[model samples]
Target chain A: MWRGLQVREQSLLSLLLPGLRSRGPRLQCQAAIRALTGGPGPGPGGLRGELDRFGGITVRLGQLRSADSVDPATFRTWLQGKCEQWRAEGRIAVWLHVPIFQSQFISPAASLGLRFHHAESDASLMTLWLGEGPSRLPGYATHQVGVAGQCPSFAQSNNFFVLFSGLIIQTKNAWKFPGGLSEPGEDIGDTATREVLEETGITSEFQALLSIRQQHGRPDAFGKSDLYIVCRLKPLSFRVSFCPHECLRCEWMALAALATAEEATPITRRVASLLLYGHREGFDKVDLTVRELPALHRGLSYKLYHRDLPELYEKMSAMD
Target chain B: MWRGLQVREQSLLSLLLPGLRSRGPRLQCQAAIRALTGGPGPGPGGLRGELDRFGGITVRLGQLRSADSVDPATFRTWLQGKCEQWRAEGRIAVWLHVPIFQSQFISPAASLGLRFHHAESDASLMTLWLGEGPSRLPGYATHQVGVAGQCPSFAQSNNFFVLFSGLIIQTKNAWKFPGGLSEPGEDIGDTATREVLEETGITSEFQALLSIRQQHGRPDAFGKSDLYIVCRLKPLSFRVSFCPHECLRCEWMALAALATAEEATPITRRVASLLLYGHREGFDKVDLTVRELPALHRGLSYKLYHRDLPELYEKMSAMD
Candidate 1:
């Protein structure tokens, strides 16, 4: 019975999938390139036709494993070409050439209603780009379509990701954290500095590599993405750049108030855990945790670690 | 100075590799999908393409951390299209399906001497396919490829992977023990059984998941690959036919002589270690060292392991 089945399946595969069952890698690469260059086209639902191929939605979980044999450069070039093609077709708006770890820079396009794109090539490499144009908005109000800042804090005591001490920017009774989009290939430290300067006009020195925040499908004022990395910073210097056009005013809120703010996003909630339970001293001696993080930092705490039976069952069954 | 360099690099990347900076998970999956399909023409000296697009090679390495995010079906579909294109253009010959953990089988083209088309897709998945056609020279005698035969002892072995073994087949008279290829989305055990039957015509009962052989690329005659999961198999039944006439003869051989046999490949050399150190008592009472294996199998006795390092390193660096 098994032999006959095997024989039949072989025959079917030959006819159905055909001559490339084994030769897929190269051909797949070509298809991806063609799709990239083929222009997303002006489709009804924006993605402009780009997301149609991918079945819409973006972002997924990533795993970390040692890749001793793979060379990163070979993969980057292929990614570069694909991105270039997208740019030529106007599928992408702006491409940032930032390093991996630097200060954060807020997205100017965020308020302008734009979605960002980041990826490695067919080979493998990091590439970040913007997709689609300004999202058509309904009206202008406190909740209207515009920039949404994402910055989470870490506890200095736990030896994990930590938040820095800096003056906060306030606009129309609303207080917000200063953060920014990263430059291509730029490290996180540099990203933080650039963001702070651009927003608060303050220069800060990074003290440590605090904690990281990651969540999937978390509802937030700005879309469903809930992941953010937190770092500790100390105000090295400060100057008030009150650009009334971009901000109403800026001031250093008390650390206690910053930690207890009512508008704390889920990201901020986790950071508050570290800040309250983790070690801290006088404002000057505030230490940020950069190591010794517990494994259950992300959704692991909610679904896996927390005894949420219903949620746990759902997660487990999805794997099945 | 560092700040200036950061800005310049970011600007260059914005112009060059857009979408190189966003922290998007879908980005990695998309890139991996692209890499799998982006058919970049061969590089200089047949050099494998580099993956660095935004941050040299580091970004590519980051991308690899998310390798599994891309669906295998997507890869399969993309490759099928390429094969059709190649077939239409008259560039491909035999297409062999070698599922992992299961035995490998070949399907001969209706006509001979057809040029097997190299997939223009990502080379990572198809590099093995390119070498799947007729083995170089020696015709039938020198290039005999058969699945390893089973030992009744595997039924009693205490290995985790073997417990699920329903489709693993082992090759016979092979210097080393090469089992079946795992299916598109199957576990290692299922792959083993399926591959073994296709190649050797045996229904193997899984016993235990043994040590992983990571040093050499793939243990089979095929090209270098990442991981090879070894399992113990027990014989249940046999079938009459083998595909493509790749194996002139296939049957059980004494496991003890596996290392010293003239027909043994480098894989056999490693198998010699398992047989010598692996606990056993004839074919019906298989016993394995239930302890977790270290990264490198230590019990194999240093002499055998050391002798193969030079050749192993050659294969390891070959991918680069």
Candidate 2:
């Protein structure tokens, strides 16, 4: 009966339906949506139910139908009802993840008491808190967030060689560069050094910021877009002690060898290519400074091979 | 006397002093510090009193001595006293603009109920409200904020020519590219197109994301940090409508000519250079498809030459 009805009518009919009306408002809403369009909601090997439990049930409206197909008023009524149900059930919060293209839904969601939460690739997370806790959300003073990293290198046989593959323990270990999330109040330079130290046990100095791989929604991003910075670093020591939790191996493979390794992460490959051809081709470098920029709080900036330490650099300088 | 004392002592001492403590706690504290340190206090051409009147008085400790000079506790007390006074006086709000490098003060300020406000190139604006409007501040659901702009180009007589520059009114008329603050819930591409249209009145499509300049603190950033994005654009039409308030004029001069223009903003020159060199280099192009990127609610992405009409594009193709 709901299948032939328009989305607006479907929502209204679902509210009045005998079978679905008795169920939770959220269920009734979903039923109405499912009646119009069918898809596996949360099943084994589908959009995981655990994720919904952990981070609130997310409804991506654009994923269901065309912008013209659904009316904002209809969605708002359904969403508001679902939130009321959640409030009664003591669910702390609910997230309405809307496709970026469905801008018309933004106002409706806002009107439905959903506050702008965060954004991930392809979806803007507008959240509403149903349960009584602190309504205050975390605010990063600066609006911009970024991540910067370094591909540490050492001098060998008069050839400036870069590290190939660092290893991580993600499902039987894979090759990747030493990197992690930035600490609060840490700069790209500091973050690069710190992340490298923790992951690969390397003490290094930043040379030059190399390249940036910034994108908005990614599957792994906690619904927030990120800016990844790549830098070149001059390693001070060869001592290696990989953290078991973050990394299992910290082998310094040559760039050429790592380039051929099929297991290297895509970012690692891209960074390798950047190291090989970036300088000559026209990749820009950024000065590692944070105090000058207030709007950007987090970012990763990779560095370039500027120079070595004084004593070694002097000896190498004389040779060069 | 206070110069030799620790920051904690100074705060305690300021609370105790008689002549220095007669005024409100904040003023008394400052007087106590001033009595000891012998630094200038609220004088002409010091910190600019009008800014204090309009906004709140900003006490940047780094300005007084070294980055390592002031302790967080002293600054926090001084800051706390000021807020209390503001509250007592029934002042609506107050802002504490701290230097970005003075991160030690961040925790203390936060403890004193200072919230992350905004940032500029040179400082981060942390705010505390004294009035009873609402404790909750506006949160832009999108975590990142940035600007993306276009350098529209044309081909003439085998010369790959681009538009020279647009003019903006910032106190006085200045030669600048067309851009402005991102409107609430507006995408960077939309920001770029809208800013361009509003400033220069020239309609164009985004060609590519040219460069990014993100900084936390800037002198003119109103204590808020900003990210300025530069992009390449292809102009579709020559007609223009200049906005009087935002822009004084928009000109399409020779790129070579504008590059050497002595009055051109440094950023303008940098962007012009980017326009000249970006395409051949690894300067990546961004597809202006908002739907494709879920995490990104705002950024600089090029608008594909979305044809207004099939007939017009088809006719143009036939002519070519």
Candidate 3:
């Protein structure tokens, strides 16, 4: 009985939406607009999506009523019809948000050439480009990685415990660590050392990653997230030749003084105290050291940042 | 003498590339294509760009001979001509790579509406979208953040020190922590707890961030970078009701056994040892605690992951 009904609907769909019919056997006939909008599917609004800035449509499936309750076959039919309509309307992209509960719809979506762009704990985002060329749809979680170099002055004797600081041209009277955005394919350590050289003309070696700050909606980063990594550096050359465009002043200041200075940023002050602690107690307590490990793919490696394992524990684990 | 020559060149530009004249007062001419391509500008390749997948062109200024030596005025004129040519060919985007040494060209490029996309230590990449709607160009360093929840079993007594482990269906005999990728706008801790509940049907509370791994060129992530964070969790429910699709088997294994088990992945083994160390000494030694800080924008806050400062130091710094 169900087969007969499906065949009748399929014939009707072919007559009504010729675009869907030409998409091969994958296109199945589902309920029409009246059934989708007025019937028991996707709540009162149905599956209508808002137009995005890039001539794409983004449908938030999670917002639909009983989103997960829809049968997979029915959802697939509906999606095929929607695609045909969107393509005819000159839409360039389609972004579908399928909540984890409604993940059954993912297979149907993927079969239609929709690819997984990214997934969150509650849902996964899939995208399809209907444009002439490749999908110009952007990637997920666009983040800018910035590295700050905390270089303590090279101590000629045991008496000095000063730190080198740069006064940023953009910020009034605020002392900041010499740093900049990490280039594509650049390592954290390499970025820290290189930025220190460019901004302050201080050659340095990366010692350890001290802290990480993750912020979102940065105006400078086009409303994307930013990851700021602070690294301890060992100064190779102490002479200051600061870039006039980047820094107003560059000088060595006492760590204690910087820690209490009202002119320093909160992060800089917090790191200053942390550095003081490391100087007194030991660096191992505060440092997140880097180690390279083989990636799942051959000929590729990744960087893992973690607290250094104690010597005794390392030896014990080595026995395995 | 310079002013007279500049006026002549500007008149010639208006006649040759009418598109430049319509762009208003910002457009200025200095040199022609022969001077730009054949002479000292942008090497022998003559400022030519390769077509991108999205009907755009990408010109790497860093690859040019004496790239930084090009006068900004001359480069500006060359850019105007190229833009006019690209527009006529129905190009959708223009990507210009300007090295730090050649940053003088940035002003001219920005005058033409090219905005900063991303930067490396040596160069900055800028882009302009000429598509009908809006720019669909993707963001830099696309990263997917994945979280793994390490949940120890809920012990009824002091003697039991077991940990819940799941055998991933994708890998043969390899036990992994139950976790998933974080959703957009979700916190790290929230993702850990939510994933554990979804995959294992085990309720857990997020404890502390344990480790971080940054890898690049992941096939699963559309050839972008991946940041995997491991978090410690306190299990609320001990029973295992694993999703069959994601796991082959789920069981509670002794920490000592799992730490030495050959079936465990290298990272799993390493984390196990760290957990053991934390269990014996204290979590404070291995944990990177989370703190909430005010973002630069009003009504927004960001998460900072770092080591816990000593109580004495926090108190001392509080005085400041």
Candidate 4:
């Protein structure tokens, strides 16, 4: 129905009547979608359930990544899940706000990779689109709420994330990293490290590339970006340095503790996400899976035997 | 006539003849092009004579910076004179053996502000289409021949030109810039610097954007890229650093100073151009007109003379 809507922009009720009679029953799909997301009710819930039953998850990821790839059931299911999760988490109980769409748009000159999209209604359970080469893949757009995991080890477990106290530029009498506009031909990593050193007086090393995240519904903004690749850096020395032109203050934040004042405008909840995700997930091993593994691996007697199988990776890659 | 030739595959000659005749004295423009590029032998050297009358000459500068911006010819006579000096010095004579057509080509992104077209004729000059930006301003793509100037303050006094050694990346027993495939949301600059550091173990500060240039007409292959951006960096603590996975050796060199034992590959030439241009012209102040001014006074002169100077600054800002 959504596919037809994108193309013809027709009413869903019109397309459903014929299929309603011949296609057994779609009421289950509608029910599932609704169960996942309480609002916009039953029709969507059933649609979600029906789509999941068919196992067309990849199609949904595509819708978020490209406009051309559409999967009504997948979108419905993802949206429902997000709604349910948010509601259960109490945010929905307060205001019932919906998360919009999100995308990781890229230049064709770049390499081939998967594109994901999150439905505006469901911020989680991003729709994934797979493709090779420069051809545009299908995905969704609008905005999306970023999902960042927080872990305890990132805060105080190591000194790798700290730098010298006096080594940052002071803006309004505070020490901080110096990051501004990206110069022509500069890369993100270049931007990050340069900003840090220029604003604060410390040379640092970029340790690892971490997560790509998005910002949604910024109070002053409209569109949300897809994941931004985050990195971990360790400062080499303590140096009281300041570039009066770029920043007012730079200081070290304990991985375990954060100083939340209006002074740190841009580096808010996001830093916490970066630290926690970087530590707990091992930075490089963040698992972004598409579906729950087969239940037999956990509930059945065969599960024990399956644990020893070596063909798992090969089979998973083949994805029949 | 040249524009007609330019639309070779489209039968534009037949379709636009009436339009051309009605528009202006295109024949004059055709004659002008041929004479400037030394096409058709009896090309009358109209462009050459203009330069001669102005004491300027046109000499071809071969594969240097992959990308560059040509400033508006302010003192056309001086421009011609500069070319004449180079040709007189034998610096421009290298083209005789270089097979003018075997060069790479690059197109400026609309962001950089330049454009070119494939010439109808197979000859190098005829093959290049250069034009000034504003519609009233005419521009032509020429095979540039650069003359070296004396810089006593620097180490070598060749006064002709010097290229940098750092541009070439040698690692993992193979040589390739830290540059690789542009990932989604990446551009040429992002690729260039990343590739440099990835391949070489040194990171530099991006100081200024230099030029956007292109090579043209390679009998054996399609043209590659010439991205020119000026950057400053501290040299490595040691010269033997290698990335076993990406490269085996990385070193800097002055092209003229390179010995037979330190020869470079074809791609190395592309990087050489950037180094040459940066060292000679000063990347931040790329516009030749600015280079012509006394180093201290050019800033004020640039601010006062350029058209829509504010807009130009804005354009530069966007790239930043």
Which of the numbered candidates is closest to the native, going by highest lDDT? Answer: 3
Query: What is the interface root-mean-square deviation of candidate 3?
Result: 12.7
Best of the candidates, TM-score: 3
Model 4 misplaced regions, further than 4 Å: A1-177, A180-191, A214-228, A255-267, A273-320, B1-320
Q: Cα deviation in Å at residue B34, candidate 4?
A: 39
Candidate 3 C-alpha lDDT tens digits along A1-320: 33454454456566777776556554233434335322223433266667876689787777766764666567766777666656656789888876544555665677777766654324457788987786655556456678898886534324654343422222444677888887656778998999889888889888888888877777667566777889989888877788886787877667676777777766777787788788889988889888788766778898888888888666545433
Residue B17's lDDT in candidate 2:
68
Per model, kept true contacts as a fraction are 0.00, 0.02, 0.28, 0.00
Please give the distance, in angstroms, between residue A223's alpha carbon in candidate 2 and its true position after superposition. 4.3
Candidate 1: true interface contacts recovered = 0.00
Runs in model 3 lying further than 4 Å from the true structure? A1-126, A129-139, A154-173, A316-320, B1-10, B13-126, B129-141, B153-173, B318-320
lDDT order of candidates, top first: 3, 2, 1, 4
Report how far residue A140 has shifted in candidate 3, in Å.
Answer: 2.6
Put down candidate 2 lDDT per residue, B1-320, tens digits, no spaces.
22433354455555676454455666557565554433234321132112354334445544545545556566655556555444544555655555534544655766776654534223445566666767433222222344545554543423654444323223243466777665543545666777777677777775545445544443334223445555456666666677785665666655544444555554454455444443334333222121121122344331111111123222322211
DockQ comparisons of all candidates to the true complex = 0.01, 0.02, 0.16, 0.01
lDDT of 1 by residue, A227-302 (tens): 1335556666655574564567765544444555654332233333333333442211112222111111232111
| Model 1: how far residue B213 lies from native, Å | 27
Q: All models: lDDT?
A: 0.33, 0.48, 0.69, 0.30
> How many residue pairs clash in all the candidates, one count each?
123, 48, 2, 95
Candidate number with the higher TM-score (2 or 4): 2
Estimate the overall C-alpha local distance difference test score of candidate 2.
Answer: 0.48
Q: What lDDT tens digits, residue by residue, belong to model 1 across residues B1-320?
A: 33343344344444555665454464453453334333333211221223222211110112222324433344343444334323333332223221211110011110122221121111111121222364321100001012232332322123332321122212344333435433222334555566667666666665544333222112232222223345556657744344333455544444444434556543343333343334432311112111111111233211000011123222322221
Over the stretch A110-191, how does candidate 2's per-residue lDDT look in tens digits?
6666665534323445666665666523222223344445553542523554434322222244576776555433455666
| Alpha carbon lDDT at A203, candidate 4 | 67
